[model samples]
Each structure stands twice: as structure tokens, then as C-alpha cells.
Target: MMKAKTRKPKAKSKGKETPKQIAKKLEGIGDGMVADIKKGKDPSFKTQLRGRSNVEFDEDRGILTLGDKETTRNFLNIGHARKFMQTTMVAAKTRDYLNQNKTASIREVYYELKHTVPNSKENTFDGQTESDAVIVDLEHSVNTIREKLNLHANPKGTLYGDITLKDKMHHNDKFNCAKLGRGGWSVMSRLEPEEIEIVSVNAKYVLVIETEAMYERLVEEQFAKKNHCILVSTGGQAARGTRRLINRLNSEKKLPVIVFTDGDPYGWYIYSVIKQGSMALAAHSQYLACPEAQYVGMTLHDVETYGLENVTERMKDGDIKRAKEMLEYPWFKNKLWQNQLKKAIREKIRIEQQALANKSLEFVATEYLPKKIKEKDFLP
Candidate 1:
């Protein structure tokens, strides 16, 4: 018989009320004061001094006090006190959120609130510690709500979505094929590398692919059967898990990787992400790129060599424009990227990996895959 399940207790929110909520409550009290004045009576401190008044007028000291216990000894009027209370409340909350959520990035919180909250206004607090604080409690609340509801946390790996049988089967086939290329020997013991596995790949060659579809197709066509090397897919822009895996492949495995991507600005940026690390988090630089990783491609050169003229599509004007701008940018002025940009301009087209599909799986199985394997030189 199954044992009874024990549930864990939820974490209390530390009763930390947001400044907006505090401000709203204080504003209500101020409204009450206005009502009292309009009623032809001096605002009485008697019944108004109930739960957490957050406002006090010290007649003896000629001062007013807002939320904190400390007194502000000089105030012109009730309006001045009210403004102080509102500003103080907002400032205090912003400080609290930043201090408490160290992992919570300001930009992340800002975007989260901007997208999730209606009419959300974002402003930098000019006072001490204000520049770093983001006022996006609504977004933060969504995360708290999800935790309370016991919803599944978002996927943590580089690859997103469910791992299908087809994916696994394809991975298995590639693993087996690579083993065949090296005289039926396997460098990797497992068919599926751990989500964050660190393999000792020192001085080995690593090949990085861009899209899952391409990876799947290449594996299915048995490209690995002709090449004995480590293969990885960026799974998009080196997500946390992907970054970890790449680090392991580089630091532990000691493999130099070569990046193969679509010949577009987005693809070039993706390669830069793996190489230079994402600007979003500057901390991952030493952990991601395999410093020696050169770029191979679905370049304009490939489009012509493969006789895919008709298959090449007109470059989106925006992409071409950005590519030009990127060519001038200091970071992207390298010979490899310049070559890619020049090709994109001269060809007036962008060819996708899918264009290779029309070349027939037989052609991929017999010629292209073999050529790539023979040319593979990422390994030291």
C-alpha cells in the first residue's frame, strides 16, 4: 500500500506590505482628514489614531511624522506631510524589494511588470539606492501566486518543452552513429547527456548547431556516422542549463567548439552570446564559449554551392539594414562576421537550413554530411 503524503508548509510573505498599498491606505486617512476639515472641525487626533496611522502632527515640536517611528520636526502643512508620506512609502518599498530579491534583476522585473501589469509606470528613484530598485510588485506577486498554487516551475534546461520520443530516438541514433565513425567506440557513455552534465572533453572537438530541427535532421540523416566529435545545440541563446553544459564541454571535456548558424544578424548575435556571453548577465563569460569556436554556416556561399538559388528568399529589409549596422559595430567587425555580412549584401538573400531539405535526404545522406565530417577541424 502507498504511504500517506505529507505536504510542506508555505512560506509566509514576511508580512511585507508594498509601499503602494501603504500609500493607498495613508491616502484614505488623508481624505478622512479633509472630510473632517470640510465638516467645520479641526482634524481631531482622537479616533483617527487607530491601526497604523502612519501620520502624526506634533504640535509641541511643530512637526509631522509619516510612516516611520522617527518624527519629522518641521512641516508647513498637512499637504506637505501627505506628500512626504507617499514618497517615503514608495522609497521604503523599493529598497525592501531590492534587498530581499538579490536574484531578481531590475530589468527582468521591469519587463515582467510592463507586460503583466496594466498602465504600469516605471521611474528611477533618484535617492540613495533608488536607481537599482524596480517597482513591479504586481509581477513579483505573480511569481508568489504561482508558488502558492504549487504550479510546476518553468523548465530549467537549455532546451524548452517536452522531450519527445522522436527527439530521444534521434539522439540515440546520432550517438550510435558517432560511435561507428570511431570504430564502434563510444566517448560518451550515455545516450542522453545530463541536463547540466560536465564531461571531461579536453582537447576534443565540439560542434554547435543552432536549431533543433536542423540537429534532428542531421542526426536522422546520420551525419554523426561519419564524424567522431562532440555535438551540441545552442537550444537558442545558451539558457542556464545550456550554458552549464557548454561550460562542462569546454572546461571539463577540454573541447574546442565550432559554431554553425544561419547567416543572419540574429544568428550572428546568438553566436556572440555563446562566445562573449549575454549582456543580460555578464557573469557567465568564463563559463560559456569555447574560446576557439569558429563559425561554419548556412551562409550565402552555401546557398550558391548547393545550387539553392531559387530556395533563397529575399532578405528582410530590416535584417539587411541591421546587418550593415552590425558590420560597422566594433564588436562585430571581425573577419568572419564581415565575410558573412558582405555575402548577405551581395547575394541579397538569406538562406535557411530548411533550404537544404529540398536537396533530398539522399543527397544529405550521401554527400553533404560526408563533406562536413571530413572538413571538421574544431578538434585540437
Candidate 2:
């Protein structure tokens, strides 16, 4: 049996590799291609093939990770030539970003590299998708994240609660999420330890809410302040940045993570992605997934226990299909999850977090959440 890889706790300020160090790695890749050309061999770029088929769920660790499958982009092959060229261009531009100590969004990187090819009418890249794919290719090949290469995606999600952090890279600002009031601190896309520092946490646990409306309701009720927990709003499916922040908080601060979502397959899946890592970005799961996270709300049982069936929506065909699919996933193989999935499929009913408002606006913040958490009521 293959032994599972054990990850170490990340240091509070494990700064990223310097620009020169990253450029050296990029240069090695270029040098290899040059040596291949000198030896009259086909120059190829090899990287782990990304997607569902090339990923494996590590049951012990509860994270989807890249499997051993790999694909090569060979320069001599007609089909692979275009991609190979695009990948080379992306690597060179990323080296530039590193050497210049500059940062850019994925979109910015695409535009910066887009131009007419010399002595040809064809453009270097047709769209951002091509560049984006190559960037990920570089990431897996180099065994580093894009943030180290001074690249980032657009930021999403919001955080509110009793946490204080410092931004060392830009403006050197230190702020507390609690003091930010209603707006809360925007979770930055580049939340790597080097950029953001977690100074102190005055919370018992972190509550990640799936919807913005529900998050707002809790905030209005001063849920975080009263319960002494950090509140994170994913808005919908969590972006990579949001997940990473949650992972860091859970791992570094040693705080428990509790997820609240609608009582439906889609919402449950969102919680799953947060806890076990998604296949699309599985390569970086060690730094992103929070395996310790537990589902806290919107269960089918809650629909009955809280008298919420009156406000529950009938499940759609897609929802039922998703629920059935979850029953087979290794991570969802537990009896608790199996019963929930079976019940969801049989009942064909889904409840939203907002349905708690049927009782009262403050019901969730004051009663439902407190009671559930106190009783250690959670779905594995």
C-alpha cells in the first residue's frame, strides 16, 4: 500500500522563494529544451495531467490529489506544438514577473503576453484560457504555486470576526476583522503566509457560511461577537483564496472549523470541497483543504426538527442526482452521510439556510446555531 503523505504545520511566516530562485527554476526548464535541440531530440514539456481522471481521493487524508498520470507537450508534434509554444511564452513571462518583483492577475498576464507573432499574422494567444492553462502547467511542473511567481486570480469572499492580521507585502497595514464592522475584511486572493500574517485570534472556532445573505443575517445579529467565532462568507462556491484562508486559520490557529450551508446536495458539496479539496485544484490541496471541518447546519433532520418542512423547496432532478452521486464518493462513505444522502433522495426536499427565518430573523444566530454547536450536532 502507498503510504499517505503527512504534511507539516506551516510556519507563521514562511516567506516565498525569491525572484532569482524562481527564475533559476524557469531557466532550468528552458535549458533542458535547448539541450534537447542540441542533441537533435524532440523537446517536450511534461506535467501531471490535470482533471477528474488524473486525480485520486486520498481517503485517509480526506483530500483529492493528483495521480501519477502525466501528459507531454512535444514541440515536434503538430497538435502539441501550439500548446508547447504557449507554455514556453507563459514561462518566460512568469520569469519576468519574478525578476521584476511584480504581481499580476491571470488576466493581466494574458494581455501582457498577447501580441502578433513575428513574421506571422497569427496571434501568440487566442484567449486567456490558453495562458491560464499554461500557468497551471508551470505551477505543477515547478512544484510551486502561482503566488510565488507573482501571479494571482481575482479575490472573492469576506471575513468577519475576532481575528487580527497584518499585511506585510503591501502597505504594512495591521487590522482586526472585528473592528471592520459590517463590511468586514475582504479575503485577498494572495493569502499565502508570506503576504498575510495571522497575529491573534480571539475566537473559539471559525464558521464558514455558504451564502452571503445568511452571512449578512448572522453579522446583523452579531453572531460572531456573541459566540466568539470567526465568520467567513464564501458567497457561493468558495474561491481558492477563500479556501486557503480557512485552511490557514484552522491549521495555524488550531481552531475548529464549522461549515453552514443550505440543506441540499449543492450546498453539501460546497462543504465537501472545503473539507476534502476539489479535483480541479487538487495539486495544491495540502495548502487549501481543511479536513477537520464539520458540517453544522441545513441538514434534512433539521428540516423536521425545526419545523422547516413548510419552507423547504422540492428537490430538482439535478439535486437528486447529485445526492445519489455523493453516496458513492469515498469521502462521503460514512453512515451519517449515507443516511443523509438517502433521506435527501427519498424525501426530495431541500431547505435553505434562510428558511430558519421562518421562525424569526435572530433564530439562527441566537438559537439554531448555538444549540447545534453546543450539542456537538454535526454531519461527518
Candidate 3:
């Protein structure tokens, strides 16, 4: 048999960053583009794309990762020119925002660039997608992620916890999460940990609830205060801000994190994104995932365990498809998760986090959660 040739890996850049490296990086990108224009040369850029086929899970690191391939954008290429132009415009706008010490959402970036080009029907950006991709590109190119470029995506998720911090950006005053009333602080906005200092904490662990309703119930019951823990809700799928807070809590505060979600593929996915990161935003895993986080309940076994038979809904075709697809994923190949998926297929049913309500509103918080935490019943 003939031997197959194996290619060597590309060597990485070895330069270390100096002080004000970020500011210089932003300036360098813009300066290069201007130099290209001055020389009558078309501009170009590259970004690592995230897709199902290209995403892989690093077992040791416990986060999804991108492949070696890169997507290129050049002004001379008709197919990519418009987006390339939009990206450069976005970078320029972000530079201004950063210089001025301000932030703007992806939507704002769209509107800021949504204007007709001179003597042309084409607009700088027809929709938000054009600008959004550009921001992700910036994240990869600059080797930094955050809205300091004045480029930010719409923030998602909220947090209630036993953390006390000072907001240096706005009020420059101290605030405690435990002291907040029923409504906790809105963490959907950009969470600059440096600005919000943690003064004191009563939490031994952090509980990330899947459903907003359950989170509100826990908040109303003063769950974090009573249990001496941090309570967080992503509202649905874990968002960037929500994940950042969880990762910060786990890595920085040395806190154990537990997640509660329904017994379904989507719910399971929520847990996966927190524990092992997701395919879409895998590149930003450093701040967006807490691989140490674990899932507690709402598994197929929980259906029988909790007697949630009546509340169980029939699993749809899509639900089954998602579960089967998850079985093939490297990170989800463990026997526990495989069995959980097989059980769901055999049962042909799905249950929501709200199904815990069948017992009582407080059953999840008081009975289910405490027992799970004590037993250390979590899926890694």
C-alpha cells in the first residue's frame, strides 16, 4: 500500500503584545486599508467561519473549536466585495467609537452605515447581517472580543446573585446583587468585569436556570439570598453575556456551577453550550463558556422520577432529529448522555422546565434543586 502524506501544521505568530497593543492593532488595520487605497489597490480581509461540519470539540479544553480553514473577503471579488466594504466601514466606525470611549449595538452599526453610496443604488449596508458578520470578523482579526470597538451585538440574558460590585463606568458606585430586590441587575448589556468589581459574595455555587419563569420564581423567593448562591438565567439558549458571567463566576470566583433545564434536546443543548460551548460562537469560548458547569435535572429519567407524565409533550420530528444528531457529536458521546438521548427516543416525549410546576411553583427551587445540589447530580 502507498503511504499517505501528512501535511505539517502552520506555525503561529510569535510576537508578544506591548502596552496599548489593542489601540495600535485597530489603528494598524485602518492605516493598512488607507495605504492600499492610496496605492490604488483593492482591500481584503479574512475570518474563521463557524459551521456544523467545521466545528470540533476539544476534549481536554472542553469547548467547541473552529477548523484551520479561513474565509477570505476581497474588494476585487464581486461576490464578497460588498460585505468587505461593509466590514471596513464597520472597523472605521468602531475605531471612532473606541477612541471616544462609547459602545453601539450591531443594529446601530447597520443604521450608521445604511446610506446610499455616491451615484449608486447600493447602500453601505442593507441589513444588520452584513454588519454583524463584520463584527465577528473584527473579533477574530483583532484577537479581541467586546464592544470597545463600539461594535456590539444585541445583549441577551439577566443575572441575580450574591455578588457585590462597583460599576465604574456609569455611576462609579458600589452595588450588591444580594441587596437588589425582586428584580436583579440586567446583565444583558456588555459585562465589563473590570468596571463591576466584586466586593463581597455569599455564593458557594451558581445555579443557572433554563426558564425565565423559574428564575423569577426563585428571585421572588429570594433563592440566592436564602441558599447563599448565585442565580442566573439565559432566558432561552445561553447568550454571550450570560455565558461570560457564568465563566467569570466559575473561573474567577472558584464557584461550582449547576444548570437546570427541561428534558428535551433543546434544553440539553442549553446545558451543552454552557458546559462545552456551542458550534456558532466557538471561537469566543474563552469568555463564553464554563466547561466546569454541569446539568442537574429535566432529563428523560426525571420524567418518571418527578411523575411529570401528564405534562409531557409528544416529541416532534425535529426534536428526534436534533437528539439523533447530538448523538454523533464528540462531546456528547458519553454513556450517560447517550442513554439519556436513547431514553427520550424510546419514550417519545419531551418535558419543559415549567412541568416542575405540576408539583408546585416552589418544588423546583426548594425540593428538586436542593436535592440535586446535595447529591451533586449533574451532567458534565
Candidate 4:
């Protein structure tokens, strides 16, 4: 019985091999098996049982799976795979530099890496291979890293560097006239809104005229006495100083503003500046343009409606061309421009605010300003 009680056969250790390990061993044994198969030698029974049919062979499926799938492919055998890895490492280092410098470009990264690699090979991979495959792989890796890290491409080459929307807003707030006064006017120099003096403020409304000539005429004509609104002249294009002053008037004084301008494109753009900041500049959009201000104008329609046909001047070819081009602009293609352009095409004329001066100081002072104030329609 003791002799029969031999140690129970050692339990077979069913330790399972990982897919990666299995793949490696299969790859190692595959070359010899494939050579044997090529030589027309029948695989041994044991090899056959083990499913070894050829070198570098796939047992589960006959399909070749090598040098393609990134996760499975060996970097040494596949040029693209090796390049991809190298590019990834370079991109990581570049990203680190970008985090510190914040103004690195693709070209800069390429040159920097090229300098670090031996022989200063600009296009070649490790100075041995000349293939765009590596550069392409590097670009792909950089893009992937950018997506994963939520990093923005530094395309602008800005001085403060790659800034976010929040950064822009923060910078805008710092430069705000309300915060820094007219002394910080440099920030808003780009907007170019008219400058007007805050002559008086009662409560009802704010009146802004486009040109200084109009302001002088209104004052000389005694229009200020009739209309109780605060009068200010956006002294042409609304300069930086003017914008700062307007900001103070609107925010601190809390006055609802109305713009009076000529019916031409330039005047329309000026009125737009007071209402919805100018598009030409980038920084002053948020601070200078008051979204709430309304436009009250000397429009093309007023030329006909007011029986001022004699005052209407012939439209220049330049004016017509500009009007047509306005159709392509986002804001100008609306009903406002459509009506204006149709009138311009039909009448073949353009009207200026100065033409309204002929209506006599009494007519303009009494009828014109009152009608605009009541109707709340900025454009004629």
C-alpha cells in the first residue's frame, strides 16, 4: 500500500500565456518552421500538433498580421513604426518646450529636433534613411498628442503666445477704459470710433452725431434746446479717445445712445461701431462697441420720402461696386442693405446728410429729429 501510495501525479500547472508572449514565441519559432516548409520537409508530428506551419506564421488564422497594426507591430522591422515612436518622443519634447515658451511652431520643432539628432539630418530619419514616412508619422503623432492634451496649435505666432479665449477676455478687461482710463487708449486705437464730448445728461436718451459739421450745425440751429437727449459727436470713425469717453458715458452715466449718420457706407460703418463694434479690429470689439445703442440716420429712402430729389447725387461706379460687395458681407446682406442697394440701383444716386441742411433749420430742428426720436428707426 505504501509503495502504491506514490506521490499523486503532479497537477498540470495550467498557467496561461499572454497573447503577447504567445505571439513572441510563435514569431521566434516561425522562421525555422517556414524554412523547413520552403525546403519541402514535412513538419514533425510534434510541430504539426503545435500548429507550426511556417516561419512568421499565424496559427489562429492564415492571414499575415505584421508591420501594420501599431500596437502589435515591432518597431525594429517597420520603418513607419520606428519613425512613429521617434516622432512621438520628439513631439512630447516639443510640447514641453511649447508649454514653457508658448510660441513654438512645427518648423521650429522640426529644426530643434534636427539639431539634436546626429548629423543634422533635416529630412532623413536618424541620418540613415531619407523618407517622408518619418515626418508624416511625426505629424500624426503630434496631432494625436495635441488632441489628447487639449493643446491648441500655435499658428498666430503671438507675442504673449498661444492664448485661450479666457486669456483674450482677461486682457481685454485689463485694457478696458473703465479700468485704466484714457491713458490706456493704446489698446483701443484700432477701433477708431468718433470722439464726442458729454455736453449734458438728463435721463431720456443719448444723441450721437457722425460728423463734427453735423454736431456744429445742430448746435448752431438750436436743435439741442428742442430735443432733451445728451448730444455727442462721434468725431469721425469713433477714435480711441472717443470710444473711451463713450464707454464712460454709457456705463457710468447709464444713458441709452442713438446714432445719427449719413446714409453712405462709411457712415453706416461708423454707426455700426457705436452699436456693434467694428469688424476691422480684433481687441476693441468687446469694450468699445455698445450693443444696445440704436441707429437713427439720414438714409437713402429719406431722399425720396422727404421730397429731396434735387439733393440726391449720381452714384459713382465705386459706390455701386461697394454696395454689391456688401451683399457678400455677413451683416450687410440683410434687409437693410437690400433695400438700400435696390434704391441705389433704381435711383442711380446717393444721398448725403448735408443735403438735409437745405430743409431749413426749423424743419430739421422740429420735424426731422422728433420723427427719428419717436419712430426709433435708425436707418431711413
Candidate 5:
């Protein structure tokens, strides 16, 4: 009997993978499965299982990461066959999209691939959820993001700053965020370096706000101009694009990131997701998480110091429950957060970023932020 030759997987690129690269990786998976079948082996592949149990927070790196808990999905296994088939279908569709230089939403991919299996009554996909899960599986299997495969989620978040951006993949136009009027530049879902270029930055720091209302207030007050900083609004929780932009501005442009959010457990969780990574997306934390980011406001301590106690809202059961749960998180186990959570749970109260309006609309942009930054008063 002759020994079979073994092949090592190719090394992935440092940042974003090109469409060609993505297509090659997709093909590699198919080829590997074919090779396995020909070699009299199970046609199977492994993917890191994702969930709370499989996520670990790296103390040194200050980011969440997926642990080495991989599960093999075999084409011959009944439990894994549906998902394996779905995953391959998604990969095939994604490769077609890449070859044609076309982009589609995850929803579009689901619809495009939805059909009744040949000689079978079962549908390839019952809904978008099944297809969406398989897309993520294919991403993990290929060691690349869906964006690289010519797919994207809905775009969210906004940015207003004295920065210029070049859209190399689309318009090939250079535009300044400052001149975009009050609406600001809509942060697109695909901000991969190859797609969008951060041409120039003339800012000192980046202010990531949790809400759009606060973002608009800062823009209206010319906060970015006066402070010489960038204003990024995550809408609510920071999306992958917003987080990646924040990471790029901090790491590449040498700008410090400060997050401002409502003084509630949910809002603080948003800040945590920005500064640290979330369990769901831990695999891409190095690309999306800004661990160096600081939290600068809406702290429970701020209510009394700033005389905004009257505006504080009573904490609901959910808020109190969340606050307690956060205390157990390794990242949130610091002295500052310890005091904040204990106080919030004890006091049964929460506050919003908008509560600062009691002082004045410009107070946050002018007084609060400047004082905090100057004193280096930020929670870890």
C-alpha cells in the first residue's frame, strides 16, 4: 500500500481577505472534503463551537477569544448532515458572489439559496436563521469573514469628524467627514481597509457614544471641531463596523478612544462590548474590539457629583439583575466597576446620557468631556 500525501493549509492574510483569496479558501474546503472521500475517510470538517462556555477572556490582551472547543461535522452523520449541506451551499453561493464582484445581504443569500432538494420534500433552508448560521459556519471553516465573501449585514452607526476617507472599492472618491453636513458619514458595514481607506486624520481622540441622540447633540454643538476630536455614534450597541473603525482610528491613527453611554447596566454592557469583545463574536475580537478604549461618563458616581440625581430613573428588576451579573465578569471585576455596580444595585437607580441635558445640551460636549479627559478620569 502507498502512503497518501498530506497538505498543510495556507496561511491567511493579516487583515481583510480579497475576493480572490476568499474564493480560493472556499474552493480549498470543497477540495479537502473531496480528498477525504477519495481517501476512504469521513467527509468532515471542524469548526470552533461558539457559546458562553467556549469563550474565554484574555487578561493580557483584554479581549474575548474562542477557546479550542471544536466539533466535527461529518457528511455521513444524520445530526450534522443538514448543517454540512447548508454550509456548503452558502459557500458555493458566496463564491459565485465573489466571482461576479457582487455583494448581497445575508438575507439575500438565504433567499437565493432557498429551494426544495432534488427528489426530496425537505427544503434546503426553512428560514433565514438556518442559512445565517451556516454562513457563520462557512466563515469559521474558511478562516475569513463574510464581508470578504461578498456578503454584509445591514449598515449602522455614524461618524462626524475632521477626517478624510477614500472609498477605493466603490466611488474611488476622497471625502471629508467634516463637510458632510449634520447627517455625518454613515459608517458602512464593510469598512475593510481594502474597501475604505482612512486617508487622513486630524483629531486627538475618538468619542464613541452609545446613542444617536447624543451624537446629534455633539454634532449640533460643533463638538468635533471645537475639541478637535472624532465623534462616533454606535446607535446603541456598537456594531462590528463601528467597533472596527474605532479600533483602526485608535491603532492606526494613534487616536485614543473614549466611550460614553447611559448610566445603566445595559449601557455599560455596550461599553464593555466596545472595549472588550462579546462572546458571540469573540473569534473576530482582534479585528473589532478596542481594548484600549476608555469609559468616560454616565457613571453612577456622576449623578451626585453633577447634581443630576433628580433626573435618575428607578432601576427595574432587569437592570438590577444585569448589574449583579456583570460583577461576576472578569473584565468588570475592577475597583471602579465594582463600586459602580454595587452602588447601582444598592441604590436601585439608573441614569441616561441625556440626563446631562438638565445641565444644558452643550454641557456634555463642553464641560463634562473636557474635564474628564483633562483629569484622565475614566473607568477601566
Candidate 6:
């Protein structure tokens, strides 16, 4: 029987930032500039240039690691000139936001800074994409995510579980995913560790689902209670909040994480993002990536094992391209992953998690899950 599920503690958000800490961070940027001037050195801000060259697949850790190649965006260099100015400006603005205890989205940041630069004719930012990239740069430089700077992405995921959360956004009134009628907590917002308190976590493992339909079906069936696990769904690509929550569970709550997705390149990439960290946000890997998480999937072999070939669909061009790229990455160079990719490319077929629908909605919970868990058939 499902245990009586209820959120016990009152939830309250704490520590977006106090005035003192925010002021200090803002002042530090100014001080760094002043010291550079005093030392007769060019005022510069150093940050890692984020790209393929800077990111490498770590075979041992099974994650993408950032390289030590650094770029000093100084007021003197031709290229570094504008970036240096932008860095300080963004830092100052972020500190201001934190000091005010106000939050903004990536889009909001672009609008706020979209005015013409004081000295230069070009507007602060021509597009949201530009500001978004700058926010990532800020994250890399400051060793903090944009959320702490009071900036958030449009939320994109949901979670359901026996675990309870005390959010800083809420008044610390505790809430559990199981109690949320349906939909649980819409995790579109960022999951800042300092902001959310995991008041209670009786669940044993975290089951991350890629499809919303599957997540809903499982929730309807009371799968979390039946299996003693938390269910999370990232509508498509798992967002930062979803990924961060998984990391916290693995690192702090010590909950084993199992990722369930379709048997395709896209599904594989989703699993990669959860386990090894996203290449775009590689700088925040430690906070966002759950390296210990395992992929318990709809692997290509599952096509035969579950007798799902008829339900499989043909692979698309984009799918083939992505699979090729993943094949080159060292983190996925292992024989198991290589064989799966090769099978997909050669067969030109991909399976969706939904295909298992033929077997019945509860087929995943009642059949796939138990067998995978018992056999330890997770993709490492």
C-alpha cells in the first residue's frame, strides 16, 4: 500500500542573497579594476572561452571536463576590449539584482541591458541570444550559475515523489510532489541549492523520465509509491533545475538515479546531459551534472529483448548526425555505447519510449523496470 504522503514542514525560501554579500561581490569587481590601474596593468577580466577546444571527454570520470585554456579580456586587446567591458557591466548588474533580492529571466536581462552603450554606438545587446551567451560567460567567470544572480531560464520540467521541498520562493510551507494533485512542482525555475530545502526524502531512488506522457502514466499508477522511487520528467531536454535536483539527490540525499528514455540518439543525448553534463554548461558541471546516475533505458538491444522492432521507427538524418558526434566523444567510446550507436546507424532505426505503449501503459513500471533493476542492466 502507498504510505500516507504529505509535506510535513513549512516551506520558506532563504538566501537569494543578503545585502552584505551582494554588496561585497559588486565591490570586488570594482576593486579588481582599481588594483589593476594602481599596478599600471591593463584592467581585464579573465574567463575560460567555452567551446569544443576547451571541453574534453574524460574517460576516467566519464564526463566532459573543461580545459585550463583561459582568455584575458583586457581593455587593451582588440577582441578582449569589448568583452572586458561587457563582463564588468554584467557583473555589476547581477550584483545589483542580488542586492535588491530581485529575480530576472534570461530574456529580462537582455531587455534591461539592451540600451546603447555609453561610449560605443552599438546597443548593449541586439538580441536575447547574445545576452544569454553572456550570462553563461558570467557563470563560467564567477563560478556561479545565473540563477544566483537572480536570473532564470523559462522553466521546463516537473517532478513527483515522496520527497518534500521547502522553497525560498514559497513561505517555507512544505510541499511534496505526491500531494500536488497532479503536475507536482513545475520545475521551470532554476533549482538553487541555497533556496530549496529537501525537508524529507523517504524515497529510495530517483527515476528520471524523458517523456511527459510516461511520467504522467507512472504517477497515475502510483508508481513512486509502488516502486519506492521519485519520478522526474524533463519534457524534452532535462533543464538545469531538473538536473541540479538529481545531482543534489545523488550527492546529498545519496539517492541512486536511474534515467529512462527512448532508444534513439536524442534520448541518448538526454541521458548524457543528465549523467556527464551538457557541453554548453560544462563550466557548471559539478553543480548541474549527476555523474553517478545510470541510464536504464530502452537501449537498441532492448528492441530485440522486449520484441519491440515493429514499434520502432526509422532514424532521421538529424538523429544519424547526432549519433556520429556522440560516437567521437571519448566518454562514450566504450564498447557498449559504440555497439548501440553502430546498430542505430546501420539499421537506420530508433525506438521511442512511447513504443512500449503496445505492451500496456504500466508495462514500463510492471515489466521493464523490475527486469532492468534486477539484472542491473543499466548503461554505464
Report the number of the highest-TM-score candidate: 5
State the lDDT at 15 in candidate 1.
Answer: 22
**Who wins the lDDT comparison?**
2
Candidate 6 TM-score, true structure as reference: 0.90
Question: Model 2 segments beyond 4 Å from truth?
Answer: 1-16
lDDT for every model?
Answer: 0.45, 0.88, 0.77, 0.47, 0.87, 0.80
Question: Could you give candidate 4's per-residue lDDT for residues 312-352 as a string of tens digits?
Answer: 77877877776665555444445876787677766767777
- Write candidate 3's Cα lDDT for 161-231 as tens digits: 76876777778777877667777777755665644566667788998888888889888877787788898
Q: Look at candidate 3 and give me any clashing residue pairs.
A: none
Instruction: Compute the lDDT for candidate 2.
Output: 0.88
Candidate 1 vs 2: which has more lDDT: 2
- Using lDDT as the measure, what is the rank order of every candidate, best first? 2, 5, 6, 3, 4, 1
Q: lDDT at 11 for candidate 5?
A: 39
RMSD of each: 18.5, 3.1, 4.2, 23.9, 5.8, 7.6
Candidate 3 off by > 4 Å: 1-21, 37-42
As for model 5, its CA RMSD to the true structure in angstroms is 5.8
325, model 1: CA deviation in Å? Answer: 2.3
Q: What would you estimate as the lDDT of candidate 1?
A: 0.45
Clashes of each: 7, 0, 0, 14, 0, 11
lDDT of 5 by residue, 1-380 (tens): 11112233233343466688789888888899999999999899778897787787777778877666788899999998999899888887898888999889889998899999999999999999999888777777777777777788888999998999999977798999999999999999888788899999999999999999999999998989998999999999887788889988987898999999999999999999998788778777777888999999899899989999799999999989999999888888789999999999999999999999999988998899889988999999
Across residues 201-281, which tens digit of lDDT does each residue of candidate 1 receive? 322366667776666666665544345455566545545445545555655656665676665667776776666554333
